[model samples]
Target chain A: MYGGGGGHYDGGGGAANANSLFGGGGFMPSQSTAAPESSGGGSLSKVGPERADAAAAHREADHGRGAASDDKSNFAINSVEVSTIRLVGRMLGKVERVTDVAFILDDGTGKIDVNRWENESSDTKEMADVNDGNYVIVNGGLKGFQGKRHVVAYSVRRVTNFNDITHHFLHCIYVHLELTKSNSRLPSQINASTGIPGHANQVRLPNNQATTFSASGNTAGNDVSSLVMSVFHDPAIIDREDGITVAYIIDRLKLPEEVIKEVMQKHIDDGNIYNTIDDLHYRSAMNG
Target chain B: MDTSSPAAIVNGEILNKFVGRRVRTVVQVQRNEGGMVFGQSTDGHQLTIKSAMDIPVSHFMEVYGIAEHNQTIRAEVCTDFGPNFDAKAFDGLCKLANDKFKHLFL
Candidate 1:
């Protein structure tokens, strides 16, 4: 009953044959999507069982590392759990051995040894291109051996984009801030305050709740940018033709003069505000 | 290789914070004279780098060394970042790393 006019056993043929049966459509539907309605159900069903077995094998392999709860000492920086770390740095030195290869990497913040272990399926030929002074991106797990910590590298590739060097450092800083500052709101505090019955054990608190906590916790420190703009956007001052003066903002916010000036300049440059009477006086773009 | 003391990245503006400590910064070389390089830092401050090797003028050089003073670096290693490097972005990175996220590095 198949459209291509072949025996039922001929369904074992792959996409090309399936395409013909589907009236020569240019786009190829994936096996999983095609399997349910297609006439080649038998062959596709066989592939399904094989895929299931492979997935099972993959799950078994991942079981060890996936047990994050059991392993309390899993690699962490600033008390944030990090399973894999990606670092960009200059390769200071390299040592090759039969079982593994080790290289010292210096990324300005610190220097650490990154080791890539040899496997029967993979060859160390790719590492031949890496040399001293070459900047490389190392992705791996952090491990300690005999009291010395080193990165057990999964892959080491030479950096082609010059921007990656700067990007890596910025990324490190971003992740550090995300972990330490943003995620510092304890789950216990959320439980104590909110009393959300089901969310007592949940680590990921609601975004609004986190915002509320941070807003209430450190008003003067964290929200300086927003606080600066609030003066310009204030209902009382928003309609002023000459705009709000920097002195008024400083007096209202009670922040340092330098910070007020810097934030004002940034907002002006960003087109969020513009000069109304002079550079000293500014009006929010939102006012118009 | 004394890798234990990893250099903290600094721009001209924040060099004073890392005095007597290992630091790294990118500077655009303005002139070179007698083993000393005078350059403009990413943050547009004048920096004096003490180097034994000849440094290329008008090129961006990443200097890794001890911060001798507010605007001086005792250069241990210098890598030429080429003349076309982005100074403004690097300056922003330095500021963010030092100011908002100082705890991450220090």
Candidate 2:
């Protein structure tokens, strides 16, 4: 039954062969069950248990660094293992070499050198339009040689919209927080199933519901603005005559004070909320 | 060349935390006086930016350099963010980058 080259094994013959090999009594139960299936036969059912045992042994061996021993260089930042990174920054300087082109990038946070290999293809002109002071997005792998770190770029493209710069920084922060803090925030079922550490693809939020702010109509439901609004629109706080205090909102949200204040200001500007009783307290404008 | 220290994104309020360290901020240029630029931070605090070059007034400017004081920055690099820039959004980003999600950046 386990033979290659499409050779068919006769079921009754295979069962008799197994019984003779295993002395009959010990292998009888599985062979009897396998007899009904003419094509698979006793040998196929007999190998199933062995295959599972081998797989478990292989997994155990892999866990002990027998196979993945060379993965020690998978460096982590904020506990998230980084392989490829997307960065938005301004090109500070550039140099063309025989085999590759190197660029210095400053993304306000810090500076790093990006190296793009040159090949005998039309794509050699990839960095042709890029100039100093131009904002560009780089997709690359972070590499370290002789204790110095740099990026080996796969693709580099100029950023036309300034908002992308903002988005990139925010995205980096979001990803870092998600990977590091997800254990506390995510459900236990998700954590158990997604046991692989530092894999971003496995991280899933409990709710993907996009709550739109009535005032802007553009804000995503999962953003800070919507979160703040949800607290106000809660059944308990929605009908309070005096509205909610900033301290109360701060207590419930667990966000930074400056972040909540900024969100509140934005909501007020968008006409979603208004000051109630005093400047420190606020009520949802949509309540009335 | 000094990639060891990364600039922390800050607004008016978070500036105090990174004094004497490299930091970046976006502000609306209120006026340019001699070599110094007076601006309003995204969070509405007044800031004094010391730049060698003249920066245009009434435009949004992103300054990156060492934070000398709570409301001052010694500008190493300054970029114009154009006339119309979203201060509110930038302010929110500053708070998020510095306060809640600071580990990602610095």
Candidate 3:
């Protein structure tokens, strides 16, 4: 979901915690969940690198390094307290240069900086991408700057229109915030064997998203506003078959004393027990 | 008998020395039959020093004058502390041999 190289820190304790978590990103790297979604890893309990291409690309990107990638989709989605991505249904905003070489991308939720490096020889790999005002997908961690949070896109792909886009692995608890704004129809189904888009259908939530995620009834969405975690596109989940099952890991998080029993039993019974501060808020909203 | 123990060991090259309680005297340099983790040559990828024991430490080394710790080539006495070097610009110029950041002994 993000590389840990950039040093972004804010004054508050929460911000410091966030910065530290991302700083040590290489310590415990995660390969994108895209791989298994692409390959026909039909078994519900099993999830591994889905495709050889994805696995190879991911392995190379994360080679000998911890936590490096544009698509740290699975856990990062449920983790970041506040995050946003603009792949579609959004207008390109101002592209202000924060540093001599880098710029910050601002979508609705917040802005993310396009971090540059001293050792990196050229902006060639960076500037070759699409500019602001056009829709693009950014994959990186949220960083605190002068006063706002920004993303450092490891890679960017321009999006002309949402309708033309197909084959997305929307693996977050809540998938709506992916677009800066979207009037287009959301994806609803996944072909288990091919990992490709099957049909144009709409669910309360988008496909590839965990069932526990809900905009209205979500308990996790309460504590924070929009309560977004990390967001990125999974290159896997293309046309495939066998079967794909969504497993919930948040069910394992231990909640406060008051709600421990309900959470544990519900979790054991396959009831939703979200893992993050944002998740807690949304779940509470759903409950009330 | 193997007189190697009383000598200074670095990168597997044994520098046979006149043994002393605090310092050892340089005699002759001999390459090791065993490998260690540090070995390098100029203008090439770093050499891997394979050791049956511990991996090598520190990528850089320097020998310095005992007084100011300025790197100097002339050291009649030597210890694991090195020739006594400071972080001065003259830091790396003090090797009895090449100080090209390579293992002389591994």
Q: Which scores better on lDDT, 1 or 3?
A: 1
Per-residue lDDT for A117 in model 1? 81
lDDT rank, highest first? 2, 1, 3
Query: Each candidate: what lDDT?
Result: 0.52, 0.52, 0.23
DockQ of predicted model 2: 0.16
Where does model 2 exceed 4 Å of error?
A1-73, A76-81, A120-122, A181-288, B1-3
Which parts of model 3 have CA positions greater than 4 angstroms off? A1-126, A164-288, B1-106
Across all candidates, what is each one's fraction of true contacts kept?
A: 0.35, 0.43, 0.00
| DockQ head-to-head 2 vs 3, winner | 2
Clashing pairs in 1: none
Ranking by DockQ: 2, 1, 3
Give the DockQ of candidate 1: 0.14
In candidate 2, what are the lDDT values of residues A1-288, reduced to their tens digit? 001111111212222222111110000000000112211111110000010001000001111111112222232322223334455678877887788889887765456677888674433666775778887666555555554456676556666555556645544443333333422333443323321233224222211110121312332324567667667756567778788988998898788999999877655543345566776778764442
The collision pairs in model 2 are A211-A221
Put down candidate 3 lDDT per residue, A1-288, tens digits, no spaces. Answer: 111111111112112222211211110112113323222322111001110001000111111111212333222211211222222112244343434235544221122345433233233334444565444333343333443323443334444322111111111101212211111223322112112132213221222232213221333422211111111112232112211111211332222443544433332122122222332321211110
